[model samples]
Target: MKIDIVSVFPEYFDVLNLSLFGKAQAKGLVEVHAHNLRDWTHDVHHSVDDTPVGGGAGMVMKPEVWAECLDELLGLDSSTSESTTEVDDVSTDSTAAPVLIFPNPSAPLFTQRDATELSHADHLLFGCGRYEGYDARIPEYYRAQGVDVREYSIGDYVLNGGEVAVSVMLEAITRLLPGFMGNADSIVEESYTGANALLEHRQYTKPAQWRGISVPDVLLSGDHGKVDRFRRDEALARTNEIRPDLIERLDCASLDKADRKT
Candidate 1:
């Protein structure tokens, strides 16, 4: 995958070069570039934000600056006419055109399913908004140009900038890419993954007994059937207690008699 991030504080992403993400880059599994949004500015101050129109507290990012940067990155001409069609979802085909994303606090929450879907994209361009956020027309204009524009919020809270939200989303999306992790199976059974979307059951390592707390006996019995059942029940109970919303969304057909009992 090819990722292009536009942010005023590009240096904040330097740590992307230090962990598994770095290894993915080294192995040619992904390519990432962070660009300073000010580079697109023409003024002496290279200013990228201005006081909001009508009335507002913080400055809103300039649309002209974002348009220039995004146009160049998306390979679109500055004067290109807008298309009538608009895309509503990210295309899963790796050969599809690049998808444009913006992190917005009022947008739909980003989920693991979104991560799974975007992992197939060939290229992703992210515009990290700052201050009061970018002018709303930026995404509207792109959508009219037939770009697969997506706006997502990581959670319910607010942040000072989109940089951190972009980081969180980028990690979630990239780690699901093929060959990004050493153990692919680990991704399959994780919380919010698979058809069930339940929270993961607890895990224990060797030296099962510690501080008078012992690992479940079923885990040590060498009985695969009983072990799986115990884990499934625990997963159901945990999700029911902590995230009943996920449980409520579960399909009736996906749950067997055993799961229904849990």
Candidate 2:
């Protein structure tokens, strides 16, 4: 998969080169490109933001800068002097144009399901905004141009900018890509995954007898069926205690007789 991140602070993404994603990039399973948003500016100052038109307290990112950056990345412009700044490694799959995502606090909640869906995309473009945010008209205009524009909010709170949000989103999405993890089974058993969307069961490792605590006998017995049942019960209990909202949304048919009786 190819992901393009356009942000004024492109250096912030240097952390991406540290873990699972770094290995994925080394193997050519993922290609992540971070470009400086200010490179698209037209003036000497290379300013990308301005005072809000309605006299707001914070500045709003200019739409023109975003447009130029996006157009260059999409390979829609010709006869441009900023050839050196153009994105040359973009995918040309032609099945679909890259999905443009703007992280904000007002959009629909981003779920693991969204991450799974995006992991299949050929390319994704993230526009990171600073100050207040990108001009509202930018997304609208992009939508009018047949681009699949989505605004996603990671959580209920606000951040100083979208750079951190993009980082959060990239980690979630990239790890789900095929061959990204050593154990594929770990994906299906994780929290917010599978049909029930239950939280993961608590896990314990070595030193099972530590401090008067012991690993469950069912887990040590090597009885696969009983172990599965124990883990499911623990996951259900944890979900009920913490995020009961997820349990409420589960399908009635998915619950077993024991679950229903409980």
Candidate 3:
């Protein structure tokens, strides 16, 4: 996959060069290009933001800068630029890889499902904004242009800018890509992977006798079926204790009587 990140503070993404994202690039699974929005500026000031027009407390990113930078990155189909899209499979062709607008309190909330969907894209462009955020005209204009643009939020919180939010989103999505993690099995057993959207139950490792509490014998009985049942029960109990709403959302058809006991 190819990801283009447009941000004023391109230096902030240096962290990407040292972590799992860096490893993914090295292994040829993904490529990331971080562009400095100022490179597209026209004036001596090389400014990318300006005071709000109708009366606002902070600055808004310039629309012209976004247009120029994004055009240079994801240019028109007729452009002769070196940048081009190539998908290996028949299913991926002719799709406009989306540019995600980070979700915020004022917009729709982002979710794990969104991450999964973006992971399959051939290209993804993340636009980072500070101050009052990018001029509203930018996304509006993109929508008019028939671009695949949408907003998503991480949580019910305010982030300083979309740069770090892009990083957070990449980290969330990249780990799900095949081989990005050390143990693939770990993903299936993790919290929020299956019917359970709540945290997984507590796990006990050796020393089995730690702090005068014994690990459950069912875990050590060498019975795989028993272990699976024990784990499922623990998962159900933990969900009921902490997030009953998630349990209620789960399909009860799969639950045996033992699972509903709690």
Candidate 4:
């Protein structure tokens, strides 16, 4: 997979080159790059924002700079503002056109479902807005051209910019990519995975018992069936106490007799 992020503070993504992402890049499992949005500016100040037309408190990002940056990344002529712009023939596979993403607090909440869906994209282009936010026309123009433009918010709160949001989203998507992790089963069993979407059960290791604390007896019984049952019960209890919303969405068919009692 290829990911391109256009942000004024490109240096903020330096951390992407470390840890799992760094290893993914080294193993050729994924490719990630950050481009300075100002590179597309033609003015001396390299400004990417302007005062809002409606007298807003903060300046809005300039659509022109974003257009130029996107054009360059998508292999279109940056100087043209024509709405017919399309991603250059990416590959023989028609699905290779890059999917554009805009992160905003007002957008639909990003979830594991979104992460799983995005992990399959051929390429992902992120538009990180700052100050007041993105010009409404930016996404409008792209959508008008039939481009895949999606806006997502990580949570309910607001952030100073989309850079941190992008970083978070990137981590979620990257970890699910094939060969990114040593244990593929981790993805299948981890918290928030589709129908079984519940907080992972508490885990313990090492001496099992410490300072009068002991691991669940079921875990030490060498009985896989009993161990699995204990974990499911713990996970259900945890989810019920924390995020009952997730439990409410579970299918009726998935609720066993024991689970229904819970």
Candidate 5:
């Protein structure tokens, strides 16, 4: 997949190119790019923000700069505002439209379900903001032009900027892409597998007996069928204790009679 990011603080992405995403790139599993938004600015100060119209406390991102940048990226310019706009490396696939998402604190929380869907994307573009926040209607502006603009948040609390959130999101989504990991089943068998639940089923390692405890006999028995039953119970019990809401959402009909009883 080819992913792009437009941000004023493009330098913040250095760590991405040297981490898991970096490895993904080295393996040719993904191509990630972070572009400076200012490169699309025309002002002497290379200004991309200004005071809000309603006398707000912080600056608002300029819609014009964003329009120009997006037009260049999407190759939709017919009497467009930019003179040097280039559509160089954006990938094209016969199967899908490009996805453009913005990271914001007020948007819906992302989940493993969303990550699974994003793993199939042919191209993705992330919009990162600084200062106070994005213009209230900036995302809408692009949406009006038929861009696949979506605003998503990491969680409830706010961070210094959306760059960190974008980084976190990118890592999560890209790692699920084909060929991105040593074992593709690795992600499937790990946390949030099959559903949006947190953490995989409990696991145990060597030394059947510890100081004052012992491994579940069902586990050591080497009976795959019994082991499966044992794990399902352990997972249900742990989840009920730590995050009951997840269990509440599980359809009783979805489980076998034994799982429902557990």
Candidate 6:
């Protein structure tokens, strides 16, 4: 997969080269490029923001700068802003058209399901807004041009800029790509994964007893069936107590008699 990230503080992503993500890049599982948004500016100061039109506290990122950067990255002609082609729905096929994403505080919350969906895209272009945020028309214009533009909020709170949000989202999305992890099954049963979207159950390592706290006896019994049942019940109870919203969104049809009782 190819990822293009535009940010004024491109150096912030240097950490991407130090972890499992670095390994993924080395293995050719993904490619990431961080571009300085100011590189697209033509002025002496290379300014990328301006005062808000209506009256705002902070400066808003200029749309023209973003447009030039995004146009080049997306391979779109700046002259064809009126393209009337229909935008395609997000698909799981890696050959699908590229996805344009902007991190917005007011947008729908980004979830693991979104991560799973985006992992299939062939290319992803992210525009990280600074100061007050980029002009809203940037995404609107792209959508009009038939781009599959997406705006997502990583959480309910606000941040100084989109760089951190993009980092969080990028890690979530890329780790799901094929060959990104050593154990594929580990991703399947993770919390907020699959259809359940429940919080993951607690885990314990060897030495069973730690700091006087003993691991669950079921885990040591060597009975896979009983162990699985114990973990399922624990997950159900934990999710109900910690994140009832996930339980409320659960599909009734997906729950079996055993799950229902739990």
Top candidate when judged by lDDT against the true structure: 1
For model 5, the superposed segments whose C-alpha errors exceed 4 Å read 79-95, 186-199, 210-213
TM-score (C-alpha) between model 2 and the true structure: 0.88
Candidate 3 lDDT for residue 238: 77
Order of the predicted models by lDDT, top scorer first: 1, 6, 4, 2, 5, 3
Q: Name the lDDT value of residue 68 in candidate 4.
A: 82
Using all chains and alpha carbons, the TM-scores for the candidates as numbered come to 0.91, 0.88, 0.84, 0.89, 0.85, 0.90
TM-score of 4: 0.89
Can you write out model 6's per-residue Cα lDDT over 111-181, one digit (the tens) per residue?
88889888888889999988888899999999999999999999989899999999999998998887887
Model 2: per-residue Cα lDDT over 1-262, one tens digit each: 7889999999999888888889989888788899999899989999999999979698999999999999877655675554544253444432345789999877888888778777667788999988888899999988998888889999989998999889988888888766889888537734465456988888989776999999988888889988888998998898899999898888777888777655
Off by over 4 Å in 4: 78-94, 189-191
lDDT winner between 4 and 5, please give it: 4
User: All candidates' lDDT scores?
Assistant: 0.88, 0.83, 0.75, 0.85, 0.77, 0.87
Candidate 3 clashing pairs, residues 3+ apart or interchain: 103-152, 103-153, 110-153
| Model 2 worst lDDT run, 10 consecutive residues | 86-95
Better of 3 and 5 by TM-score: 5
Candidate 6 — what's its lDDT? Answer: 0.87
Model 3 stretches with alpha carbons more than 4 Å out:
77-83, 86-99, 103-105, 186-196, 252-257
Looking at model 5, which ten-residue stretch has the lowest summed lDDT?
86-95
The TM-score obtained by model 3 is: 0.84
Error of 3 at 2 (Å): 0.3
Displacement of the residue 115 alpha carbon in candidate 6, Å: 0.4
